[model samples]
Target: MSHAGDGAEVVLRLDRISKSFGALKANDAVSLTLRRGEVVALLGENGAGKTTLMNILFGHYLADDGGVEVFGQPLPPGNPRAALAAGVGMVHQHFTLAGNLTVLENIRLGTEGLWSRGAADARAKVERLSRDFGLAVHPDAKVGRLTVGERQRVEILKALYRDARILILDEPTAVLTPQESEALFATLRKATALGLSMIFISHKLHEVMAIADRCVVLRHGRVVGEVDTHATDKGALAALMVGGELSLPRAEVRVPGAVLMRLDGVSTPNRGAGPGLKAVTLELKAGQITGLAGVSGNGQAALAEIVGGLALPVSGSIMLKGEVVTGWSPGAALAKGVARIPEDRHHQGSIADFDLTENAVLEGYRSRFSRRGWMNWRAARAFAEGIIKDYDVRCPGPETRIRLLSGGNMQKLILGRVLSAGPEVILANQPVRGLDVGAIAYVQSQLIAARDRGAAVLLISEDLDEIMGLSDVIHVMSQGRLSPAFARGTMTAAELGLWMAGQKFEAPDAA
Candidate 1:
């Protein structure tokens, strides 16, 4: 199973695979192999062709040259159903389940024929699958009611129910907690013991080292290197993938000014739908970044929305710069020198169909780019061009559709636009969630720069590493309650993980 022994079975083999999109060669003459009962980790930067290569193997894309052989037989090009029949299954980052449908109904949609099994039989199989693996989800529960972690388990169950031997998981743990991730890897190990081969795609180095047998590094449309996970360090893997030295942002010294914002016993009732803030009290001072760390589906979004003036708490007051600003609209928040970068970039950060110019003018059109009740297209275009140049956004031109840009580029544009306002208070939510290492470094540096410029920043993220790296004060949010804020370097990750799991921790005593 390791390195494809002479007698070992090869489940997947790609030889001299190449694909081109217009002038850019997404994948170039790449070769790979997946043996039975082995886990391979795919390492690469953004736009490095890892997804393209995986897509080619899964029949989502037709390669210009070379071939994909599954189980020692040639796989048809651009046919996902055929790939599934050949025992190849792909779990995308975003779950494709319908919210209104039950788990069993969603799983049965395209996987099985009506003649194959009735509802009762399907439920029985789902129960067995759930028990067999560590994946537990109520088959009859509506998908909308399930948590993010539960939905992920359902996704894996769907693939397993299809009788897939070879599975490809893309950023599987991107939204899971540390405990949930441990459970998932434990389940994956059990599956591997039963002769399942897998390819895991992720940017988190420590997880890959723990879960994968070996690592394959890709750089700019080509295979650069491969090594055993145990033998190579994360630094080596990052160097190989990024193709250069990695420089991280250095923390700067700053004297934090007076409190820019204070939340006093803020409480929001959710009407029994989900979690909401409860008697939360907090403060954000100028020239410091306050990081809120939590699992994906916790109250991070609610906290961010309330602070950004999108959601108003039922009780308590929000004081900004010594003025009560509770129940203020988003425009009022912006006018009062508050900037917000939402958690979900596509739906909350920017309009998808709009061009870069239009997106750039979203917050500033009324004041900066509008005159006499008319939007000044020339001024807006200039502002967008400035962002494109300053942020290093890679696209066709300034007028290009924002949706057409890659995730990282779109993030850069968003940061550029928000920072251009020079707001005194910032609420950044999951700012660098899906970006690559280079882009992450850039975004972190930008946030730090803003902090050094005397702005009060509220950073809400699921990444403990990010929160630990860039916070002056760190707090964990769980089940709509804010934990006591701990000064930087005062708490360990293990302690924070416990707090994120809803454990109560007493604040450190101040002498």
Candidate 2:
């Protein structure tokens, strides 16, 4: 398909866009343009102003000293309705769909009047779009009942239903499996064929290389470099984004020690309609990373929660350090030297409204930062300050709220808080999700360092590459059941994929 070139019509333009939150300038006089049928990749480290620029274009945040033009028409500042009316659509990294609503209802929401007589027409259009773009999701399905990939498809369909000519996708494949990501890319290609222009924001250099026609690099909230996709390589793009050579950390060979944590035939009840852990047996040994690979909602969260002490199995036993555990809880897990890096950093990992000092002590405040009935403010602040400095968290100070820091920095603080305690067992759930290349390397290196220090690490991720790369032993989860562990390099991705699809599993035992 023909894409952005010198002669193509410009569909969207951001001229000298600038935005600041208090003292931080998120977007510093940034300018960008999108042409008809073009896929422009917006590449940057976390907090490098990629999201800020897109938000300005979509009218989520008004530009301090610039403007946006969609289809040669000036868009009204700070008005999402105006942007939508002008054919601009955005699918944020975190979806904005109501869980209780149906797919059709979410697509039709805010676009039509209440009690409008266009229900049938909307359903028909949705079906057609789903068929044409390969976004296969039932229109009548409740959104909360859908998988992560299906939800993402619904988000895309929502934008298409609004006749969006220009689309902005932020970290679109962050939660998707390899197979699902490929499908999404196929849909994007189809969209481009239909003359839709897209601004693709992603931290995965390979995805940008595969899908984007051009790459626009942002650093410190300014346009640093722009390159044609065909002419540049991933390494070059990585350097452009981070302003240096990038090297991802690799897992080193180490003999695994004794089992630090084990779950034997564990079963937990379903979460809503989702499957829970069922007869799953797993072992985490010291000095090794045991990777769990699966599609989203396939008992990965259940397993992580069980290990992290968020939930206990309804049946079977949990053994920590070869001892049968009782009364397991977050504090209990911490006391037993289990450090958890939760999947959802914004919600589970750190509180949004709390300052860095407060969040730094969240998991250990009662035991470590408290004496008798009183709190140690000075010790807490010192600990918070230590994390900020040691972990390279770039923020104003310990007094700054965690919500104000970038995803990478926020993750760094979490890493510091947990690692500082010198845990013997580490539960890292999607540890590097949505992080830039630099941040990903840092986080992975830290995990490796922990493993080197004889920490038994349980790494859960949807990305097959990450699983294969970091895992000493790999297990695939499907239908809440765990497959037999395969040593690293013993199973190909396709073989593991079959396990993920539940094709290789034996029938469940009669209840």
Candidate 3:
């Protein structure tokens, strides 16, 4: 049966969907409809059941109650094969791609497993699909060599290769630069025009306003509101998502102190994980935010590690507070008052298997929690509890494992642990990457507060808006090289984008 209500086809529908984990009801009688050739934005705060509902739709989790319908047919529960057979596909926030495999191989992996009738036909069809969808990529290129945007395109290609007609994209633009995000939106519109419906899950209110046709707001595991994007504003949508009015904190003006940290011709080895610096020179001063803007993987991670003492520079010297601290270890840097809020919170910022109490003392256990080689579990718990209260980290309790907390909460805990150390320099790498609007405001405010307290802050981020809004001086990194620092409000986002693509922006003085 085809549902052509008002002459538009309903491609997907969920009626009174419910799911629970232990005592927490993640989804409570939720309902939704995704129509053909339309893009719907699913809005919510962290842990508001958006992902839980999508997991149910994709057969990652079995719904305790209610039913899922795809293309006007009820889908069997707890079976991904059935969901895929029904033309449902999902692109997760954390990509599940085989890095060593080629793009085409990854795309056709599960769908055409074991045997193939014609290799030429498969290649030709892949090319045709790439051409039709504006998803340009080298079919034989290694997945690991591709950029974040390229990887996302490959994921979409995989879903399409599996004959998926309805797509669910989870935080699709979270890892993309401004230019890449715009290109993604354009590609999505092209797909929509080809009669494919999409569910775009995102916490970015601006993106929701820009790309969505209809807005569905989720709060506390329930459907709180639904409205046309044209009719609703970001403020109203934000209010509905968090169940309250959320205001962005205004940036404060501050007079920068003397030079505190300097990276004089710093260079690192190209170790295959991130872009290594090529004679990159930079400076950070007290009471100021020195912003480093780039497409992620373009040396931002390397720069962060070099500064945070996780990785030693192969060349050049690092000067901290007028003292030479080259080749210093992480513990050495911590001892010298350097606090790092790492980019990857799961692997670098927090220990997943450990409880909040343990993760809280990961860096400070030697100095704060341990004496005479014996660990003080009670003192660590106390510290963790304080962080939970002060940072407003929403978790079950301090005894809960770090992996069980939401991304935003984990980030909050990381910030709390590092900031509580009373550091002189702050290395905030992608500090608000996956946080909601409210959490973003909190993180930004905290960074500003740190700067106000005379910390030399090195802020590395892919978000151009954030760099422009927060930094006193901005430098663009491209191809492992650093451009000359521009004063606040000196360069536009477009100019930054060009630089991010490894293109030089020749100023009038140089011209």
Candidate 4:
């Protein structure tokens, strides 16, 4: 049921907002409204202009035509300070917290002088807010030392601390666990009860159905459908976002072959807040998808790095095709027919300043796209063009800097770059983290096709549903330790959750 009544005051409005970059129109005459104490979900496929429109609303971008009104006042174009002064707050998908700063410091950074007498009052208010909202993060904890879920809480607290009446959240739960997501939903309910309005942008339909009072769908940069939450279902919403019925690919029953890659009793040093792999013995079998599920910061990163050849195990041997490998590096991994899809696409997967053509050949340039001493720009461009067509990446051209593309399109480019190489093994790490439903289906289908082609695939994700749906065998990680592999249909989600929480593991022997 919606908290806001029909008679409730309208707190925010967007009227005929139109924005374009080059020939691509990011937003086209888009219009929306938010009532006090209401939650409106903005739904769309990637590149459908969801983020662009939100950016415009938050004053990160200026509309070519039309404007935004906050509580009946016209917000100045492209002035973030104006947006803030108007009590508008935005929490980005990728966090904006500084690593070296404390949570209290991050929240109070621009609001007031750090050494002022108001600092003590701010601390007391933060503690009160945290308790009232069920956002239980330590005020003095360093941001870099916090988990993904904790950092998200800080982001929300930052907005509430500024006395924001309207909050915009972009993919807020992408990295959060199911429990954390439920907690966030509860917090939103509390916020709305106190007369705050919000705009939630998400690809997860179930979440939209649960938390949003109304849903607005965008397609091809324009509003196509709007419906009350009580009137619409998840399937209908999915259809509205993509313009038709959506069919996600399923993993078919299959028998896997020999172990293609194996890690025997691997151990590594701890990094930052996350522990290293602890005597973890694992295998990626030919023609199989090995799924790893865990809470964030539970040694998943170290495991991915090991397989991607970015790190070496301090102990234990890495075997490839029945032979122990040495001198392992990214180049070595590629030479051995291993393709890595990194967790952070913007940082590890591709360079922001590089064009599509340059990123397509980043991993294979030395051996495939380049000769003894020179680069083949013509061949590289053709390869990039082929990937764009084959993977259905939406972009103007290969020469366009990859930073300009939406998250889903960027991921498609990365997938195309790796899969096109015809590798024997694949490392897909959180492959569809922030993508729309369509993109998730496409990426998963590609991995299944690769498995059918006899490639050993390792899928690491924080999403248990995706893991259970796609993997032939599953493993859970907790505190740098790996659980025994369970077949796809053998273990229930509850059973996996036990493992994920470290309740199912035996105590490690003293070293």
Number of the top lDDT candidate: 4
Q: Report clash pairs, candidate 1.
A: none
lDDT by residue for model 2 (43-107), tens: 99887988788778777787889989999999999998999999998898889999998999999
TM-score of each: 0.90, 0.92, 0.93, 0.91
List residue ranges in candidate 4 displaced over 4 A: 99-101, 142-144, 351-358, 369-382, 395-404, 489-511
Q: lDDT (CA) for every model shown? A: 0.87, 0.90, 0.87, 0.91
Give the worst 10-residue stretch by lDDT in candidate 2: 502-511
What's the ranking of the predictions by TM-score, best on top? Answer: 3, 2, 4, 1
TM-score, prediction 4: 0.91
Identify the leading candidate in terms of TM-score.
3
Q: Tens digits of per-residue lDDT for model 4 on 1-511? A: 3568878999999999899989888899999999999999999988889888988887889899999999999999999999999999999888999989999999998888888877789999999999987889999999998877789999999998998889999888777766677778999998898898999998878888999999999998999999999998998999998888987788998999999999999999998667999999999999999999998779999998899899999999899999999999989999999999999999999999999999999988889877878999999999999999999998999999999988989999999999998999999999998888889999999999999999999999988889999999999998899998889999886678667767778646311
Candidate scoring better on lDDT of 3 and 4: 4
Which of the predicted structures, 2 or 3, would earn the higher TM-score when compared with the native? 3
Residue-pair clashes per prediction, in order, are: 0, 0, 0, 0
Q: Candidate 1, residues 129-182: lDDT per residue as tens digits?
A: 899887889998999888778889889999998988999999998877777788
Report the C-alpha lDDT of model 3 over 1-511, residue by residue, as the tens digit: 1121336888899999999999889999999998888888898888889889988987889999999999889999998889999998888878889999999889878777625867677788889889999999999999998988899999998888877899999988877777888888888888888888889898777888888888888887999999988898989998887778887764576779988889999999886767689988898999999999987678888898888888888889999878888559899889999889998899989989999999988999999988999999988999999999999998989999999988888999999999999899999999998777778889999998889889989999878788999998999887688988888888898877877876574445521
Q: Which TM-score value belongs to model 1? A: 0.90
